[model samples]
Target: MTPRFAITDAEIATVVAEFYAVARTHPGLGPVFAAHVTDWPAHEAKITRFWKNAIQFDRSYDGNPLQVHRDATDVRAGMFDVWLGLFDSVLRRQLPPETAAAWSTLAHRIGRGLRFGLTPQNGGPPDLRGPAR
Candidate 1:
């Protein structure tokens, strides 16, 4: 299927690789990721698949992101914003303006939903790793 934007698989991979490279060193997100991500390449590949599926309808990924985030106890409510901001910067730097905006919009929507699942008002715990479903 054609991507919603004029982005290619290679471009998406580049964006994901660059984003995580910076994210791994980010003060707010680094330690959280380090705790669970020992294999950077594998993690990035999975995430690439996720973005491919999200942006291009590639169906290359099949995982529950909400559940995965919920399982990561280090993920906090405020981290979603940091993640999205970092992702947005990478998208802007690696993609065309129109593509970046389109992808960022979708990412923010997904991040908001994930954040909601991790918040207290969702009839669950205040953090992701707890009893939040």
Candidate 2:
């Protein structure tokens, strides 16, 4: 049977766009993302492609988030809470509950992975949870 939550490109774009609109200005995540990404439109498109590949299995994204976060001084384990919070809010607002659940699972997984990878002192495996309401 088909998946209960199947996301479309348009949905991905909408989520990414709306999410960044908040994240870019968020007190915690805004500076982190801004310090790293100089081009907003390009970054948004890249994020769109990244989520599309992740959620849709399109295999279109090529960038390395692990490396990027590792190199950035602003990325940290505690910051993921802020990032996931914003992402959860955007997903909850922009998509249906089932679809948001499916997408948030991936986002949480990515957040946990990035947090661990970026923190050299923390090598434990990541425990991914569904997005916050």
Model 2 lDDT tens row, 33-55: 88888998999999898887776
Clashing pairs in 1: none
Return the top candidate by lDDT: 1
Tens digits of per-residue lDDT, candidate 1, 1-133, equal 5566678889989999999999999998999999989999999999999989887889999998888888998898789999999999998998889989989888887887788888866864333222222
By summed lDDT, the worst window of 10 consecutive residues in model 1 runs over 124-133
TM-score of 1: 0.88
Best by TM-score: 1
Candidates' lDDT values, in order?
Answer: 0.86, 0.81
| Predicted candidate 1, C-alpha RMSD | 6.0
For candidate 2, the per-residue lDDT at 16 reads: 91
lDDT of 1: 0.86
Q: Estimate each model's TM-score.
A: 0.88, 0.86
lDDT of 2 at 27: 83
